[model samples]
Target chain A: MAEPVHEIEVEIKNVEGLHMRPAMQFVDLAGKFDSDIHVSNEEQSVDAKSIMQMTMLAATCGTKLRIKAEGADAAEAISALQELVEVKMFDETPGK
Target chain B: MEIKKGIAVSPGVAIARAMVIDSKDYRIPRRSILSSERTKEIGRVREAFDNAVAELTELEKDVAAGESQIKDIFAVHIRYLHDASFGKRITDFIENELVTAEYAVSTILREIASHFAGIDDEYISERAADIYDIERRLLTQLLGDVRRGVEHLTEEVVIVAHDLTPTQTAGFNKTFVRGFATEAGGRTSHTAIVARSLGIPAVVALEDVTASITSDSLVIIDGNRGVVIIDPDDDKMAEYEKFSRELTEFEVSLGSLRDKPAVTRDGEEIQLLGNIEFPDEAIMTKDKGGVGIGLYRTEFLYLYGGSEPTEQDHYEAYTEVAHHFEGQPVVIRTMDLGGDKLPYAGRQAPETNPVLGLRSIRYCLQHLSMFKTQLRAILRASVLGDIRVMFPLISNLQELRQAKMILRDVMEDLDEYAVPYNPNIKVGIMVETPSAALTASLLAADCDFFSIGTNDLIQYTLAVDRANEHVVTLYSAADPAIFVLMRSVIHDANKARIDLSVCGEVASEPEYIMLLLGMGVRTLSLAPPMIPEIKQIVRSVTIKECNHLARKVATMDSQRQIKNYLRDAATRILPEAF
Candidate 1:
């Protein structure tokens, strides 16, 4: 049986948006999970665990992103990645 | 020698060896590796990654320990290094394209960085610099060649760059970076503002500053002239060397003039006083050849101190300044607040018309207790030395009399305590407004002397709100209307036999000093640094020449003509200062 896939839609909340520094933090965090994580903007989808690919998304402030995760820990990946995009805003400066 | 002319954004001259920085691609020539060397290329790529990551981690550690704000930025760079795909992409390129490790790293990183640069969003586009920075680091390790940025500069040098972003310019160590010349940026660019605020000499928009200068090139950044000379010839070098020496010698000579009197060649004595805000500036005034304090602004005490200043706070500052020139007059101008500057603690309701609102003496009269606190301090410090009181923005005789009554009330209260004070401290009014200047003869009877505050006098007489940029152009010190008011005020003071001095922006300016002297005005209270240069002008010319110039200026109808004539006249006398 294949591992289940879970996904959630979240908004980039930080004013700096998904720039290099925040994107790097997201990819670094994704690399720690036991799942394959991918993030997609309206134009394209890319591996969330790849900083190079994540930067290609070019998601600015308020850009909506759909995060999808697949593995035995897919649920955890979905929630953590969603929290990063929505709650933590990848820990970038706010009101910038 | 090659001379490049550019817009001078900041003023000063700097001579130093050039330090070139190219922010773009390293321009590594493309070279192919033998297919057999694929393994070696991949190994080189892997090792470079490891080394770069180690270097970044070490920097991040030091930044973390040193309490730097950039530690998070370094962490991001480290994350890029540790990204699995980052290492794989370069290696994959090296293997597939049969290219050298350096070439593969440069091309792959350039591809990523260019994507960022191509983005339309400004914040997103700026990430391109970081990608370039990371690529430079990796290439530095791969090619075993050291990269030089302004941060790595250990010796004094003039930075020559194609373009410097605001971020890069802000990080420069001012001690080692004496000056800079760039190919891009206008006078009002963020880079120029930063350069000016940092007090560094910068000339931007040179177009070829970076291309013409090399690491070994000796460059002269003459920001005053907006000229950058690269590898100057022997003759040009000697000229600049003499210029550099003369500049230093001029500074020393200005200092030596502190002892010289502010008297003209015809034996006419001119009283040169200093305008100050704090006590320390009194000492600087004396050092700069000022005979006394002309306008001792007391608002700084109320504005800077967290709360309302105690009487002691006011007394201490006055005593320190008054003792600096024991016998000379120290005119303490009462708090001139609520115009453009308001007390920081009170976020007062925004007035529809701030300049016309209650300010200076008007504000003091409304807040009588605050007024009395400052008066008691002034009266108390007066006994310590020759301290005189002055009121600012006195528009009419009624306000002057009201301020005098309060001063008398405070003096009486001091007498109740048997305080040792100057029972007869002389009082004066700043003839700054049209009402005061127009009615100077009437107000002179109530005060001991008059000080023409030309800044506001010009503003009020011209009906030009100087703080507004649109009308500020019309606010001219050399305006025929302003000179008319000045003539009236000076004539009245002479007739009344009361001392008069000019304590405003006009006094510090060299172009107006001769005119002030020519107008039969013997006293000038100006910025301390201006004392020596103004004295130089006084000593070089006679009162007769000044009168002749002033007469010519009076005949001029237009402000532009008067200003040009004054600048020409002053510059002719002291060409070096102009």
Candidate 2:
């Protein structure tokens, strides 16, 4: 069977970058899906499932990133990741 | 026998031995190695350092899960540990120059920590805690050094220290330690928070505490009175024991009244509200029967993290607190950050006289963007529950008018943007400065309510720096001037048909509560724990008696005279409680 493909662009809105904790959370959520997911800024692209890679990108709070997913669950992965980043799931993390 | 006193941050009484935990006791041992083995030793140290860093990193992650505010401190520590100096110079010194591992690490750590400490910024200086934490971790990994060795409490002990850090106090074994007294720290210090959390009594900033008291000597710690009694006689010891028991019973009795209404004996309803600095305090208020939050100090959100919280941050915080009250009013005083509360929201310069310097509403109006952001956030959150906005340190009608003008602009902007908010939200002014109190009649006409902040009002009126020990003696909340100002403000507020409340440390005192009730302060807001006790006092007193006392106090010429009169009346009427 062929893997499905999904892509989306999201603008960063938080005052701080897609820093470690939030990136780690994003990776954690992406890992739940069977799809292969990746995020790309203007200069570079990295696997969305790797927290270290995501952090190294140094995405500022207001920097836009393009999310791409490819697999049987590609559309779901893209939709879920988009919603998390768009709504700033990390900022609303419990007890944070 | 000797006795010392300091500010009572947390209240309780305890009898215990002495346990002195010095920060220096946690130092690491120096490792020595031959030139031939230098490379191997450095390798081992590096590996150990890495492991220690990893452990701290993990621990930090866990702590961050609970408190995100401390994450920056942890991050700075990580950066310092990974700095080229730590790995390069220390490694080179130990490998080539042949310094002992302990000596080299200590030298580097001490130098770096001292450098950071000398930066003159409190936030950067606070990083010393991070360095200290890292050093402890490294020492434990290399030499199996454990500073906090035991957790068992065989006998009662009074912990003495220069200052207790949050981690140190949190790691303390409660059973053995009866109480703690520190030589340095204020009422709002982290050590006080830990003490309160552990249900132990503590006295802070009692200078010479370490020099005066001997270890294992019988001592009494009256945290409520901020007194430390050393080598008390049999009579005094017995009295303290009785007092301790009675206090425990009193606290338990007060706890039972947590759900009761704060009504006078003659059925006069008084609104009991909480003064909160953080959203977490709202839970405490609810637990203590607070009908609402009177003074939600927004300064703490800015002060604690050394950065301005974004509008969303303020909105979420305000929304959570408002929703917690479930329709009960939460009067949030906007960004009272300045003066002594400097180095907050990007103001770092020191002032000669912080009390009279740029602060509160005056500073807010000058910084329109920051001020408007907070106002917008508060207005946006007002729709969640009963939310009222208040301006702090409001002195004159002009300041009041200027503040309301900015608020109008914010509301208009929000309206233009189709933002959801309570359009007719109630506005109020903090009757803190003497000018504000004097012009309360005019100010009250402009605002929806009046909340007298007696802490600053007294400080400003009497020219006393409450934080300065030299002048604190002159700071009196019971001053005749304070009463006159408070009475005039309340009267003006009443005449304007606006709600009047007093939210200050003075309102927590049961004796003062009666006088305020008599002065027509229908709304009383204070710390959560004081609510029940003050409510009990209010329930026991009649309005007529309170009015009589207020009238009598109004005739007093000085603070001392008013205080004496109040003490006498309290002793006569509520002798048992007093």
C-alpha DockQ for predicted model 2: 0.02
Identify the runs in model 1 with alpha carbons over 4 angstroms from their true place. Answer: A1-3, A7-41, A44-96, B1-241, B250-257, B299-308, B339-343, B346-359, B362-371, B463-475, B567-577
True contacts kept of each: 0.70, 0.00
Q: Candidate 1's residue-wise lDDT over B1-578, tens digit each?
A: 79999877665678898876555443654556568889977887888888998998888887655564488678778878777877888889978888767778888888998998898888898998888889888877864432324556788998876666543553465568877787766554444544543445778778556656533678998866778999899999898888878876875887888898888999999999988755777877888888999899786677553478889999888988887888899999998877345444466777897777888999999989989999999999898767899999999999999999999999889889899889889999999999999899999999999999987788778888654434556778889988888988999999998989998768867889889888889999976766888899999889999999889988999999999999999999888876
In terms of lDDT, the poorest run of 10 residues in model 2 chain B is B142-151
Score candidate 1 by DockQ.
0.52
TM-score of 1: 0.58
Clash totals for all candidate models: 0, 4
Q: Evaluate all candidate structures by whole-model CA lDDT and list the values in order.
A: 0.81, 0.74
Question: In model 2, what is the error at residue B83, expressed in angstroms?
Answer: 17
